[model samples]
Target: MELTILGTAAAEGWPALFCACDTCKRARAVGGKNLRSRAGVQFGKTHRVDLSPDTWYQEAHLGADMSALEYLFVSHSHDDHWQPHCLAYLRPPFAHANNTPVQVYGNEAVVRTGRAELGAEQTIAVFNEVAPLKPIPAGEMTVTPIVASHKVGEQCLNYLFASEGKNVLCAWDTGLYEDESSWKFVENVRLDCVILECTCGPSKCERYHMDYEHYLAFKERLEKAGSVSSECIFVATHFSHNVGILHDELEQYFSPHGVCVAYDGMKIVL
Candidate 1:
């Protein structure tokens, strides 16, 4: 599988729309990889993890031929992840390439949020809402949407994208799954790679998001339980500006633990 990190920042994005914080300033000055948009990931152009408001930028910057995206896996209906207003741009004359209808899978809320754009369009596109633990097929992958700990009245998901005997744990918009079932399920499943978020910092207030400390602890637990093999690639992403840490700084903390910190445009083929 070819994995591409389209954007790495949390909701507001790195160097947010109008914020003038020191980190934002530095990010602006150090363009390149430091410039992170809202969270999203693309797998071989045929599949994508989430859709952020910066979809256009992601498409352009990644040099992605949007036509390859036949399936869009939505994690939640959050503004940063599911910007329905932008879906119209992908309809009709806008997207003529592959012209394959994009099948979007998510929770009910995710469906309700994007369905409006799916209507009255001549473009080839369809939206499907999926519940947790239910397996569905999209292109070459079989996706199992798992429950997430992000919000109320919505389906925030952590997906297991499996194909060709390999699986990837795409965990974003999820807090540490405190539920016993969540951990029990994770303990038995083997993964080639795990993509999780580190939106929280080292600070103890990491209830809704995992901090570096929590992330490390999670990795240790995965390792200790022997659930993950030595070759499993654990990648940390979906960073928040409030974390107040740079990519290199975060790398130093994760690199030694066999965890890889993702940057925009970075690709890992597994």
Candidate 2:
């Protein structure tokens, strides 16, 4: 399994365009690994998560093609997470002729919103409404949507993706797992990596996103439940400018405990 971090920031991103906050200013100073954008990821050029408003930015900067992506999992319709309107890029003949159609999987609401936004375009991407725990195959991987503990004004999800013997728990844009039933799926499945959310400034309180406190708690719970391996790696991402902490700050907090803080364009081969 291969994981790529195209973007790893909260809705506003780590260094907000017009933000003049201390954290944002600090991030600007260290403009490398600390910089982030709306979150998203891809696997081996085929499967993907959400299509953020920054989708084109990711493609341009990361050298990825939207038409080449085969499976897209919409984690819900939050503005930062869902940019169905962006699918216009997937129109007929797409950026190139060799590209295949992108297949999107999500809930009824997500499908409805995607269709409404993209119109009835028949060649961009295909949509499939899926429920939690229902596994679907994508290339050489199998993806299972897990009910997420996020604002459900629209449906949201975190995914459990497994390829070969490697499994990754895709988590972000939400605080602690609020649903116990979903915790069961997390507990029962062992994972090789955990892509978690740590969107916080050094002083920000935890809400709608996880902070260091929740991050630690998640580690403790996973250890107790034996849902991870000794070699299991933890990845923290989804940064917000308000959560002024940067990569080194996060490494200071996470590395000693064997966790990794992700950066835009970073890739991990599992």
**Candidate number with greatest lDDT:** 2
**Model 2, residue 223: displacement in angstroms?**
1.0
> Cα lDDT of all candidates, in order?
0.80, 0.81
Q: What residue runs in model 1 are displaced by over 4 Å at the alpha carbon?
A: none
Candidate 2 off by > 4 Å: 201-207
TM-score of each: 0.93, 0.93
Residue-level lDDT of model 1, residues 1-270, one tens digit each, is 878888889898987778888888888888777788888888886888888888889888776546667888889888889887666766557655564667888888878767775676525557787867878977678988888777866657888888888888889887788656667666778888998888875555546678877787777777777778778999998888777767777788788878888888888788
Clashes of 1: 1
Q: What's the CA RMSD of model 2 in angstroms?
A: 1.8
Residues 129-190 of candidate 2: C-alpha lDDT, one tens digit per residue:
99788888877888998877677475578898999989998887677877787788888888
lDDT score for residue 108 of model 1: 88
lDDT of 1: 0.80
